[model samples]
Target chain A: MSKSVRKKPAAPKKPVAPRKPAAGKKPVAAKKAAAVKAAGMAKQPDIAPLLTVSDIHTYYGDSHVLQGVSLDVKPGECVALLGRNGAGKTTTLRSIVSLTPVRRGHVGFDGLDITHSPTHRIIREGIGYVPEDRGIFSSLSVREHLDIALWAAKKPPERRDEVLKIFPRISERLEHFGQQLSGGEQQMLSIARALLAEPRLLILDEPSEGLAPIIVDEVRDTLARVKKTGTSILLVEQNVAMALALADRVVVLSQGMVQFTGTPAELEAQPDVKDTYLGIA
Target chain B: MTFFLFNLLNGLQLSMLIFLMAIGLTVIFGLMDILNLAHGAFYMAGAYFGYVVFQATGSFWIALAIAPLLPLVLGFLLQYFVLQPLIDRGRSAHLDMALLTFGLLFFTIGLIDLVFFETLGLTFMSIDKPAGLGSYVNIGTFYPSYRLFIIAVGLLVALIVWLLLERTVVGAVVRAGVDDREMVRAMGVNVYVVFASVFALGCGLAGLAGVIAGAELSINITMGVQILIPTLVVVVLGGLGSVKGCFFGSLIVGMTETLSQAYVPALALFATYLILAAMLVFRPQGFFGRTPKSV
Candidate 1:
């Protein structure tokens, strides 16, 4: 693999030649592998992507954060977006949801062009987003949070019970205000709220960003269970190990561009790419 | 002792009027982050609408029923046409909204004066109290039935507003938007719709306050300007977005104004300012406002 050469050399020319072939060869092989995997995924059905973010360029004010990021999430698949700080990982998620509008490129969700759609319309179109800060309403109770999500999504009352089952801790804190809940509990509530929306695709921005090891494991386990239920996920994560554990495919972003896209095993094999881009040795 | 009780009752009546005026202003400010100076214009419009409607129908009840709607429709039109376009332009647009509303306030005042004083040759008009509320009620000492009615209306409106904010999904979205607007929008709420509806509701309530207050006080061109400052004081003392805070703040300012007028007539105007200044020194976010988180 030309992984080592591609990792180094900020100079464009040296990496381009070796990078193109490796990047080109891997995806063709992965797609064939994915198709084979899709055939096995017949029981799950709808192996086609629930979301496709193609060549998106997003900006924050004057700063061009995401230059041209592209990735997709197949139905029931958990795709991990790995990146260093300032690598535009969060921007990618925001752009897809149109929280931060994409300056250019297409965001296709459930067979609709949502590139220019309002944030609410995209959410109504069934892409639930859990922000980096958790976006909790400080004054509202946990139950209120769940109720609002249900109301916004126009989901059934029964969905609240279903979501509560995934994070039983949230049920315990139903009466507690958002500000009163601990960080782990807040994360659980945030995830639970998003789940209650019955979204076709869930875009989580660093769900494991600031959590205890035990809590992270619990979230990972909950997400694994969620995957079993056939909801596609586009997750941005800094915890490389936890991400690798959950992701069916890993898309590594470096300075707002897709540097690598393949399976967890493929990523693990490319240690040089991980070390250079992910700061993981 | 009787004089003291009378002033206290008067203060309570004033407080209710202030509550009616301030609630809408605070909500509009909180949800949209727009300071609408022309909110007073809606109050003025409501009074004028009441006058015209009463003249046409010869019924105070009919005037009360129809007057608030005029401002409500005007508010919706103003939001849809004038303010909504500027909302997305950022903080600079807020300044623009304030200036635009100030201009609207003057424009509306001029319009009212022209229609009533020049066209109709009616100035310094007063709406007669409804037949049911015309007499005095001996509550502790002799309170006007109409004053008592205004207080009842105020409490009822407060309860309704509280229910809307605390119990409904729309309230939840509005409250959440006050905390984090982008998050509310990302949750798939058409925040623009929420903004428009809330702005209209606030204006409608202001109009209701105007019609009710116009019956008690003389309806004139300067009535809106006279009450606008005190209403702003009520909003500031209460908190930017908290309805519960606005209620209590209005009571405090209202009591302060009337009580000071009774005890130290010279300080009535200055006392509210003194209290506000003191509050600012101690609690800048207002009585119920949360301390802003340093980002």
Candidate 2:
């Protein structure tokens, strides 16, 4: 039933490589040797991506928004996904969390295939998402918002105090309704709420989208503190400088595919790619 | 003066009954965006359940205790089997759900009619007021003690509902859900379960109202349909989702209904409609309704 909803095409057949005479005959021993090699590969820091999205195709109704898009976030590292408007950056983050489910390809999280897992399951498996619009409940107070997330994550009550220490402005406006807060305060509350879940990976969509420059600096400082805690982050942002400043590596998306993936310095060296893909000179 | 006082008391009692009916309607509509036309069927089922329990147990208290449970269970079943599937089809399925529930309403009414009136040969059913509530109490004119008890129960239930929404974690989730369902789900809560539980709660309240109304007015198969229009008016007048609005809307409706019926018998039925039309013209969002924010 689930498969019917996905509309998957036939699985691609692997191309056979020229091999030694012993390779195809002794299948069991070959599988064992390959398993050993894979395990050995996992020990390498670059090989074991914490969150790997490989060639995921996603859609919004009939509109094919993300066409075979893929990226990776390594353990305890921050990777910013940068793109122009409608470049599928937000859809990439959404697909990882299965909010907009992938029609093809796999999403491996913490060494498990979670490509078809439900949104809540993805969240429970320690991925916190902060949506672009903030998604705050107008009727809920700041305290209630954090408390609900903590309750969902089954965190201790003291987690609230710890989160407050990180975002003191939220603490100051704890009793105020979510709609009452300014854009920066709401963003802080959103990030703080996601942090309380104690997720291994936090996915933030446009956290500095509409905030003032000073507020963006506060958010940057907060992200730096969060990075020090060793939680992997997948950030989707349009602010080129902010993305470059915080990201250890950057993935630039264009027309629903990965245009470039490298260190910020590597991206900085190529102004033509930036201008052509990101509309940045 | 005595006549005016009598009408006022009568209106107040009617208002409490309307509140019980409207409270559930507003919550279910608010949280799920489902316009359940079959809500009145639950009310009718409650009255019938109360009748059966009262007949078999020979106790009003026992009947009252068990009547609402039946509707709660029925609500869960309906939510799981019927409403859940429609909801999964997305926002466009709202009209389809309303039509489905409308069909459910008629089915329930038909089933009850066949079982009670056709099979059992009982034309109409009514439960006696509980022992202590049977007598009359004087407030310038004689009023039934059961009516006063209902008013008290209504106020108490309102307070309890208010507290539940304001002070509990479940209430916070519910309120958050009313504002943003996707956000609640992203927070790792199964919003479907929350929606089902809330739908059941609303259904139970409707049932309780039915059981109470059974004793006040005679229970007939057509009673659900008869009261559904007025109840919907109360819900809209109270601003669709606001409990406080339901309370005051019920009062205004009840008063208009009773006073207009008492003085100008010909316009009695139209009085509530007149007020509703006036509200639509002057304050389209209703008294307490805020304009919904686009997501």
Candidate 3:
């Protein structure tokens, strides 16, 4: 009970104070993390990853998937996880959310060991998830979805307007149910729903999947706007170009293992890793 | 026409009673995806609990008030402690839990029979209709006041529930949980708590329905078993997870069953199934259910 009530629902969606390093960890790791993050994002505090997933092994039935996956997202930085079909990209996001429990490894978030935490508790720690499918309830109206998101986040109702401004298209369809929305509209609602929670870390599985090129560009621009608000994002995408364009750091995965971690420019320089793993030259 | 009115009122009474039972079942299944076969047991236990309360207090009102608590708490404990653990351990074993509840259904039947029939040497019991409600009242012609009360209460509950689910933020949370349990949890809502609360509410309604129905029919060990299939039919006819569907489903099944028993005695037993069959053949999702979820 104390697990949730201890933290007030995050303040209205603004760039709150930069996250401090989690307590009781070696200051060396925090300093090293800060040094690595300093190269990209200047605004982040000298802290360990706002989100740290270390050596997680997840399995789907007997199939050995996500063999020792690890990654980090610094405060306000967007990390793109690049992988092919069946590369366990979505599973990694699900693992962090604890939707898919990791068999072995640590998922530390905001200073808490959350690998075993229930999905809701992990989310309550200020990580909002936009699942791969855009997870819209066909029977519920657009307003209800937004209301539910606000309620879950424990945010005031006034934030609805502020959140809706991110995706103006959804505002007009407030009365429309989930099934009534077009795919782009659904994607917008999905992001808007997560944003309503005012998370410190936002995990989107595939914001661009099944979307047209124009809509993908629209999504990228909207995400860029969200990035300005200082929310760390972990994006899993098959759209290499979108991922490369938005990411500060890219982690390439192949056959459930981390194959490379570098800047987009570094990844582009090494065509072997990019072409062999991501099918890009 | 007077005779038709009498049957219509009777059908409504049954429909209203079953509506209470069906809504509980539908909502529980809708949110948790748990087809609780023991819902009928909760209905029977409610009557037995009400019988105890009514016997001691000699007040129907008191019995109605207290009886639902037994099943409500029991349902919460069952979902939170037993069923949830099983579900967590074996996500693939949902049907096994259904069968386990099937066992629980009969276990409750035997237990009810033991306490009420075997040990107490009772064959059947019925609650007395409250004063002023026993006598007939003028509707179109003279109608049993209690039956009319049941219909009124049922309609009132339906309206209240519809408003609660459609208009409130709490209901939105629940409906969202129903639509996408994973996403709801991902949003930081404690879905297990929601599941337990819904399960408790459903069982509580069953208990309330039991006490209401007790006045109309004798409570026997087999009473819960008897209503199980009809209510299941109501749930399916309405849709798997739809409250609106439950309303229309209960009405349609109640009317046909009551009218058939009066007008064509031989078809009474199969009347509910006939509607279920038609709904299955034409719209497998029932009246308002989503495309019947394969998951």
True contacts kept of each: 0.60, 0.58, 0.71
Query: What would the per-residue lDDT of candidate 1 be over residues A1-281, giving only the tens digit for each residue?
Result: 21211222122211111111212211211221222233223322334456777778888888989987767777667889998999999989989988787888888876677888888899987788999999888988788888888888888889899778778788888888889988888888888888887887888999987899999998899888887777878899999898999887788888888777766766778888788899987
Q: What is the TM-score of chain B alone in each candidate?
A: 0.96, 0.96, 0.96
Show where candidate 3 strays beyond 4 Å. Answer: A1-18, A21-46, B91-94, B292-295
Give lDDT tens digits, candidate 2, residues B1-295.
8899888888888888888878888878877788888999999989999999999998988988999999988998888777876676564366887898999999999999899999999977899999889999888889889989888878888888888888888888887877777788788877777788888888888899889999989999888887788888987887866778888998998889989999999999788998999988998877887654413
Q: What are the C-alpha RMSDs, in order, of all predicted structures? A: 7.2, 8.0, 6.4
Off by over 4 Å in 2: A1-47
The CAPRI-style docking tier of model 3 reads acceptable
Ranking by lDDT: 3, 1, 2
- Predictions' DockQ, in order: 0.41, 0.44, 0.46
TM-score of each: 0.90, 0.90, 0.92
Highest DockQ model number? 3
What would the per-residue lDDT of candidate 2 be over residues A40-84, giving only the tens digit for each residue?
A: 123232435667777788989999999877667766778888889
List candidate 1 segments past 4 Å from native: A1-48, B91-93, B291-295
Order the numbered candidates by TM-score, best leading: 3, 2, 1
Give the per-residue lDDT of model 3 (tens digit) for B234-294: 8888887688999998999889999999999999888778778888899887888876321
DockQ of 2: 0.44
Model 1 C-alpha lDDT versus the unseen true structure: 0.81
